[model samples]
Target: MAPGKLVLATHNPGKVVELAELLGPHGLEVVSAGSLGLPEPDETETTFIGNARLKALAAATASGLPAISDDSGLCVDGLGGAPGIYSARWAGPGKDFAVAMARVNDELGDKSRTAHFICALCVAWPDGHSEVVEGRVDGTLVWPPRGGNGFGYDPMFLMDGQAQTYGEMTRAEKEADNHRARAFRQLVALLPARPA
Candidate 1:
């Protein structure tokens, strides 16, 4: 039987909101570990899936509930996928995404603008069972970042064949076919359906 409720192992309000939206149609009650006073585990893993599993396992064990976690980042082809796991770190302690975006622009310096956003999702049960999936959206980098809607590097990322950056798109538009949404869809497919 599918779980009636699951814990989302994250503290980011944006992620909580987005994940809740994704999980809602599944009929699962989503609660964040942060709301339950669960400590945020350090992401020691190098890969996105590894980090996601680490977080999911930590939350599942600590809360005695099934937990889902995601680790996502932007990878610039010119930079050799640098700032992959360090995407958040690039924002530094204050989470200054502007500075991070600037760094990305400076690093590129007229090189290949190809880039992509990657998301890894992991669902872990208290009993140690877990499943993981990854999704990516290919795109190119843009300078003089545009719009002010989305967060992180959204303003600078223009998906292939799209004119507007993610930051310029409405939430509904961006959520459609996004990396996180794709990963979540895959995860949802693997979940057992709720008993009617």
Candidate 2:
């Protein structure tokens, strides 16, 4: 069956709002996992797809509704992807992106700042059906964080050709090229259109 107003397994306001804005236009009513009272599950998986699928499947089973979940993090080439799936906990809870970004830079220290923001999204149905899609945006991580338009590592994440970091870009611009949006588009592509 086609998806009918599925829940996105996340409570992040920024993430949820953006997904809502993007999916709303397509007539896909997006619901947050918080709205459905589903708790965040432990991301014991090693890969982005594993974590994303874990949350999506858990939410789908808990709510009995189709669910989608995304896991994304900065993967620094020089640091050998030090923070891959551990981006959030890099700073040790409190979800401190500042400290996390700093640690990432320190780890790279004088080396190349080349990195990519990878997003993995998974959609799951209560009947045990699931699909995963992923996207990435290559960029350089700067020493001092810049811009106030975005949260997390946005201030430090500078796109190759762009002069500004993700935080420096306007919301519309970030939404257009963000890893999550990129992955979401791919997930949408894999989805079958509504039935007549």
In terms of TM-score, the best-performing candidate is 1
Off by over 4 Å in 1: 1-3, 193-196
Task: Show how many residue pairs clash in every candidate, following the order shown.
Answer: 0, 0
The TM-score, computed over Cα atoms with residue i paired to residue i, of candidate 2 is 0.93
Candidate 2 residue spans exceeding 4 A from truth: 1-3, 194-196
Q: Which lDDT values do the candidates have, in the order given?
A: 0.90, 0.85
- How would you encode candidate 1's per-residue C-alpha lDDT over 1-196 as one tens digit per residue? 2748899999988889888998888778999998999999999999999999999999999998888998999999999997898998999999999999999899989889899999999998888888999999999999899999878999999999898999999988999989999998888887675331
Every model's TM-score: 0.95, 0.93
What digit string (tens of lDDT, one per residue) describes model 2 on residues 1-196? 2535878898877778877787787766789999888899999999999999999999989988888888888898998886889887896768778888889878787888899899999988887788899999999998789888866678899977888899889989898878988898898888775331
Best by lDDT: 1
Candidate 2, lDDT over the whole model = 0.85
Model 2 lDDT at residue 153:
79
